[model samples]
Target chain A: MDILVFALCLAIGIAAGYRNWLPPYLTSRSSWGLTAAVYLLLFLIGCELGSYRSVLEQMSGLGVQAAALCLGGLLGSALLCRIVGGGGGV
Target chain B: MFDPKPILVLLAGVILGAMGHLPEGFDDLIGPLLRGALILLFLAIGFDMGKEPRLWETLRSLSGRALMMPVAALLGSVAGGILTGITVGLPVGLAASASAGCGYYSITMILLKEAAGIEAATIGFVANLAREVLTILAMPLFVRYFGKAGALGAAGATAMDTALPFIIRSAGKEVAVHAFVSGVILSLIIPLSVPLIYRLLS
Candidate 1:
């Protein structure tokens, strides 16, 4: 459901943009809007995280497992993309 | 941390939250507000993408090859999951589900809680959050060491938004297109993949 919303909203925005339907005021400030939204999101995320006191309290116990998987996933993808991705100038 | 401003804002929020500074009813509103913010963020990003002079042309040039980045992300994340399962002594499905969250912590946690339980959900939350934070912190280094595709792959589903600025800063604008496409693809895959893999394997 959330995925559908994400794709739908983005598609709507894209279509509106293609059609020049966005107001001039919005188009001019879109970058700032994007950045502000991201910061707002980060703040919300932090609030969400900090509110989960149980998670924070139990972090020590969960830390090792989470870290291992996180590092492994990140490194594995890094290597794999290097091997298979041709960098695609990505 | 080339860009510490966002991180600082995040820390401020965390501090306040930890202090129980939220007004009454605010906690309940977080989820809905988060969704609203995400929608706005996506629309903004999509607008920029569409506004590009040669949007379709750029995407067309990327073509099928762009799809490979998501595949790489999946394979790599699975490999990580397997190792986590072994080392952490978690069930195969549980570990895979958590690791496969692809930096999408919120939905992944909710889904895992329903499907697997709070323990799996916790792991999913931590693991996915770690992916995003790690991507943000390591992006510059990844671009320097792993090149553009590696950076994009490391970002998983976050490359579209949270991790994009870093990619754009470290890599050029050209790579940003692939990053956004890869992010969108991975984002689509994660919700389906996380629970399905759990149900199938567990």
Candidate 2:
């Protein structure tokens, strides 16, 4: 059931995007329709995270791991950029 | 420069969750909401991409530089995983999460639940979430110091959405397309890389 709902939402979003409806929302800065939709989605993500706060606290010990991942990702990305000769010139 | 919508939504979710008073069917709301949000985000990304001037010219220029972003991201993910594994004295899933981009939160949480249980899943969730936030915040700086290619790498998984607009605005169309393509590719690789690294290390 949840999967179905997700699929439906995804399909709708993609369809709307493929049709180029989202652009007008931003260009016009219209508040009533698509802007509301975008805002709603952002809010939902925030809510999801907030709902999981207890889990977040319990897992607080993973902070070091998080920091390491951030640094490692940055460094690794840099090296890759250099090796590939892609990022150096940009 | 933080957008207030996400903050408000997060607060709303927390409050609703705390109340613990949702009706019987209320549980069904989450899936649709999240899916809808993701679609909106993606669509916004595509729409913005379509509007960039001289989009092809920028893309043509980025062909060389864009190739390096994923490699850099992969390296970062591995480094992160190893550090976490050593510190935690357990096979931390940092590699996958870092490599996968922000998508790690959803995929890692699922994988952690099945492989390591609830505790590990929670850690993966938080770690991935932090990575997403960091990517968003660091994108402008990376673009400034390292240019479009660097910004693409720094954006990690969010290059297609959160960072795409800024990248397009700053570096022009080619860099934006490069960042988007690179981000999508890296995001796809995250799931495979996370478990692969964990297995290799453990």
Candidate 3:
């Protein structure tokens, strides 16, 4: 369901973009628009995270696990990218 | 380009939420509002992608290989989390779930809370939150050391939003689009993988 929403939304944007459907002013402001949308999304996510009292309550105790997992996730991906040579050069 | 505004705003939201003073129905409004924001973000992404002349050409040439980055992200995080769990004497299942959060703190924590318990959920929440912060902080370093794709891997599902500013600045617009694709794939995988991993571990 979430995947469908993501794909559908992307498709709509692509189609609109391909046809030049949006107003010139809006298209010109796309960068800021995108940035604003992302900020709104992150803020909402923060709100949701804060609403979870249990998670908040126990946050301090989980520090080690949090550090370990973050390091692990980053390190693992770094290692894999190194081996796979995933750089396509944008 | 490497603006501090997004992270600051996110922190402000968390503080406001912690205060627990949102008016009635504001909580209810969050669901639809978040979805709307996400759609708008994706639309902008797609539009930028569509405007690119090389979009289709790049996709066609790299169709199969392009997928490896996301796959590597999934595999690396899972393995790394499990190893961390064993080393730290934490339960393997809980560690995996926390790792699976993949920088998506809210959803992952909620799901783990429902499926596992408070401890697991807390770990998921903090770990994923740390992942996002670390990604933002370490992005330039990742780009320098591991290149664009590696930075996206560290970003996990956040390539679409929270980590995007750094991604765009460091890697350029084209890599930002690829990061979005990678992010979307990982986002889709997280929901399924969390439960599957939970069930398997139990």
Question: Which candidate leads the pack in TM-score?
Answer: 1
Q: After superposition, how far is residue B197 of candidate 3 from its true place, in Å?
A: 1.4
Write candidate 2's Cα lDDT for B22-132 as tens digits: 556544685665445544544444444344445545546665545556666666556645564456554545344433444345555543433444455555655666666
Error of 2 at B25 (Å): 16
lDDT of 3 by residue, B15-48 (tens): 8788897667887787677656656766887787
Ten-residue region with minimum lDDT total, candidate 1 chain A: A1-10
Provide the fnat value for model 3, as a fraction from 0 to 1: 0.54
Better of 1 and 3 by DockQ: 1
- Among these predictions, the greatest DockQ belongs to 1
**Cα lDDT listed for each candidate:** 0.76, 0.53, 0.72
- Candidate 2: regions farther than 4 A off: A1-59, A86-90, B1-68, B84-99, B102-104
Q: Candidate 3 - CAPRI tier? A: acceptable
TM-score of every candidate's chain A: 0.74, 0.47, 0.72
* Candidate 1 structure quality by residue, lDDT tens digits, A3-90: 5566677788777777888889988888799779877866776676677788678777776777777887788777788777865474
The residue-level lDDT of candidate 2 at A27 comes to: 47
| CA displacement after TM-score superposition, residue B69 of candidate 1 (Å) | 3.5
Best to worst by TM-score, what's the order?
Answer: 1, 3, 2
* All candidates: TM-score: 0.66, 0.55, 0.62
Error of 2 at B122 (Å): 2.5
Judged by lDDT, which candidate is best?
1
